[model samples]
Target: MSNQTEYAYKYIRERILDGTFKPTQKLIESQLSEMISVSRNTVKKALLKLERENLVSIENNKGATIKSFTLEEVKNYLEIREALEGIIARSAAQHIKDTEIDELEQLLLRMEHCMKQNQIDEYSKLNRLFHNILYNASRNIQATEMVSMIKTQLMRFHFRTLLIPGRNESSLNEHKMIFASLKNHDAAMAELAIKQHISNVRKTIENNYQYLL
Candidate 1:
């Protein structure tokens, strides 16, 4: 891809993930081209790439629109995430560096502070960073890529989960358990802890999906 196309891709994808572009919202190539200072053809290429990532849809008559998911699709993605994250946690326990573990510990401290201060957005950012560190430590590029792609598609719903009442405290506790298991280099416990964390998030979404909509 050219630099222009890459920029257009990141530009559109970020808006979609951050909810600036609502689901099913039409993506006009000419407008995006003007905004990103790229050609309409370049915007089209970027939209195609995003479609492959499941973040956009293009049809014969329709140009492009942000992809929307059904509740079942969301649940399916979360279930896949739970299994993949468990693998990541297990591998991270075995291969993670001391410095990486220390970073996770410090991040957990910050997350706790965020919870106490009721900084949901800040906590959510930290939560992504926390998992990213684990992803890097896991040394499994394939699984990491797959997890990230799925995450990009579900980013909006994931943030909504954090907005649910009492979810921050529960999420923080879950992260602590995951941190403890990784710090101890206990692969099985790490896997279990992370799986449980994702499972709880899935259940929370299932029970309180209205907030997401």
Candidate 2:
């Protein structure tokens, strides 16, 4: 992609993931072009790319709007995510190196600090980094690719969920358990921990976020 298109894509995608762009908000090419200092055509290309990623809906006369999901669709995606995370956790337990364990430990400490400071946004970013490290440590490229794709689809929803009251602390506790299981090289424990963690997240979303559902 050209620099202009790349900049437009990143700027718009970031806003969507961070909730700055509300669901169903219109994407006006002229407005975005002015905001990002890119041409309207470049903004159009960025919208097309986001549409391909399932993040935007383009109508014949209505232009583009941020995509929203039904409750059932979110649930189905969560189920697939849970399954992929379970496999990744198990593989990480078997294949992770001592250095990777050390890195995870450090990340957990930072996350704990975030919890103490009530920094949900910072904690959410670190939480994603932790999971990315764990998945990559597994060294299963195909599995990694699949999980990454699903994660991209759910990133916005995941960010919204993390902002829920008390969810940051709860999610940090779950990550601690997952890290402990990985440190012990206990494959079954790691797998079960991840499965339970994701299951809890699903329950949390269903119970508290009726608007999202």
Candidate 3:
């Protein structure tokens, strides 16, 4: 892709992932082009790329709109994440470096502080970084890419999971367990801990579907 198209793609994709461009919101090429200072064709190309990523939809008559998911679809995505994230944790336990473990420890400390201060957004950012370190340590490129893609699709819902009452504490505890397992190089325990974490997240979302939606 040309630089202009790439720029437009990142601009639009960031807005979508960050919830600025909400689900099912229309994407007008001309408006986006003006906003991003890109040509309409560039915006169109960018939208097409996002559509391929399942972040947008384009139809015969309609130009483009942010993609929306049904509850079942969200659940299905979480199930897939649970499986793949478990594999990642297992691999990370075996392959993670000492420095990576230290980094995770620091992130966990920061996360705890965030929880105490009621800084959910900052905690969420740190949480993503924590998993990203594990993803790199796992040395499983294919699974990492798949999980990352699915994560982008579910980014909006993922952040809201922390908003549920008492979830922040529970999530921090789950991460501590996973971190301990990885620090000990216990692959089985690491996998179990991460799977349980994702399972709890799924259950929380299911029980509080109305709040999440």
Candidate 4:
């Protein structure tokens, strides 16, 4: 894609992922093109790419809207996350280098600082980075992509997870456990830790977002 198309794509995608666009919100090409200072054609191309990734839907009459997940779809995302994240943690534990472990520790320390400062948005970004780094360390291309796609879909609800009372503390502790297991190269322990972490988050969403479900 050209630079303008790429820019439009990224700008719209970021809005949807961050919940600025909102699920089921109509995306007007003229508005997006004007907002991004690109041609409508470029915006159209960007929306097409997003549709292919299941981030948006376009119809002849409806134009485009951010994709909305049903309760069942949300459940499937978490279930898939649980299964794939376990394998990712195991692979990371087996293959993570000493330097990589050090990097992860640095990330944890920063995340702890975010928690102390009550920086929910910053903490959320670091939380994402921590997991992405772990998956990258696993060196499994297909698994990483699968996890990334599900995560992209789940981003809309992620802020809700972080905002829940006491969830930050619990999530931080869970990360510590996963980090410790990875550092020790304990594959089984790492897999179990990651699975439990995903499961906990799933339960939190189920309890709090009954309306969505």
Candidate 5:
């Protein structure tokens, strides 16, 4: 992609993942072009890309907005991840090597230190790295690509819940268990760990059931 498109994608993706642009918000081409310091065409390309990913929607009447997710959709997302990630972890265990194990260890250590020090930025980076290691090990490029996109969408909620009390610590411990299961090459245990991890995310907000309505 050209520099302009790259900038456009990065800007829009950040806003979408950070909840800076909420659902049903207009994505006025001219205003976005000005705000992102990109051309209107570039902004259009970015918006179209998001639309293809179901992260944005445009209509002739109401125009564009961030996609508002229903609770059913949220449940479906987790269910898919739970199923796919379990298989991914199982498949990954067969292919994971010593070098990959070392990389995972490094990521786990970073996560542990980041949690202890309360370094959200570093923690988040290591968090991504930890999962990337498993994704790569899954050895399914198509699934890897799709999972990355879904992961980005889930991150909006993940980061939000991180700000809630006790979430960070809980997240750290869950990851530690996942790392341990993977380290021992126990795919079934890893699968369960993945489910539990996602379940913890689902339980974060007491009133989140309202989102379904």
Candidate 6:
């Protein structure tokens, strides 16, 4: 990505994550440029890209704003995520080698360790690695692409939900079972395990009822 793109993605994504910017708040081009010390053109281009990815909405006459979703939309996104992720895990089992499997195991261990240490930052980074590896393993562009979109839309909910009390341990155990299924080459088990993981995520997000649609 270009420096402008990187700047915009990081700036906007973090604001969205931290709630510094509300969903309906306008993302003025000049304001972003001044805030990030980038040029107006760069901000405009970045907003365009985000819009293309469905992460934001730009009105030709009214400027851009963070995309707001309904509660049902969030649930629907998770339902789609569950189906796609399960399929990805199942397909990955056929192609994943032992070395790659070991690498994934190490990630689960790291995630477990991070939880014990309360290393939220490292945990989130490693979590990304786990999912990225799965996406690559699936070897299906369409499926991975859909998951990427689902993840992008759901990123805000992850921190609010996953980092909640008692959720980390639950996630760690779920990952272990999924890893075991993958290690054993049991496609059915792997699929079921992944679905369970995602279903729990849906629950976590749902439990945060104060979080609007």
Q: Give the number of the best model, judged by lDDT.
A: 3
Each model's C-alpha lDDT?
0.92, 0.87, 0.93, 0.90, 0.78, 0.83
Give lDDT tens digits, candidate 1, residues 99-180.
9988999999999999899888999999999999999999778888889988888898888888889999999999999999
Models 1 onward score TM values of 0.95, 0.93, 0.96, 0.95, 0.89, 0.91
What value of lDDT does candidate 6 attain over all alpha carbons? 0.83
Greater-TM-score candidate between 2 and 4: 4
Local error of candidate 1 at residue 39 (angstroms): 2.0
Model 6, position 23, has a per-residue lDDT of 76
Off by over 4 Å in 4: 210-213
Stretch of 10 with least lDDT, candidate 2? 204-213
Clashing pairs in 1: none
TM-score of structure candidate 1: 0.95
Q: Which candidate number has the best TM-score?
A: 3
lDDT by residue for model 4 (69-109), tens: 87667878999999999998999999998988998899999
lDDT ranking of the models: 3, 1, 4, 2, 6, 5
lDDT value, residue 37 of candidate 6: 90
For model 2, residues 65-119, the per-residue Cα lDDT tens digits are 9988777777788899899889889999999999989999999999999889888
Error of 1 at 91 (Å): 1.3
Pairs with steric clashes in candidate 3: none
Please give the distance, in angstroms, between residue 84's alpha carbon in candidate 3 and its true position after superposition: 0.9
Winner of 1 and 6 under lDDT: 1
Candidate 5 per-residue lDDT over residues 138-185, each given as its tens digit: 866776676677776666776666666688899989988887888888
RMSD to native, candidate 5: 2.5
Q: How close is candidate 4 to the true structure, as a TM-score?
A: 0.95
Off by over 4 Å in 5: 205-213
lDDT score at residue 88, model 3, on the 0-100 scale: 91
lDDT of 6 by residue, 1-213 (tens): 797778877787778756677777899888898899988888888888788877789988999999887778888999999999999999887777888898999999899899999988788788889878777777677998989888888777776665678988898898888888888888899899999999998888778747533
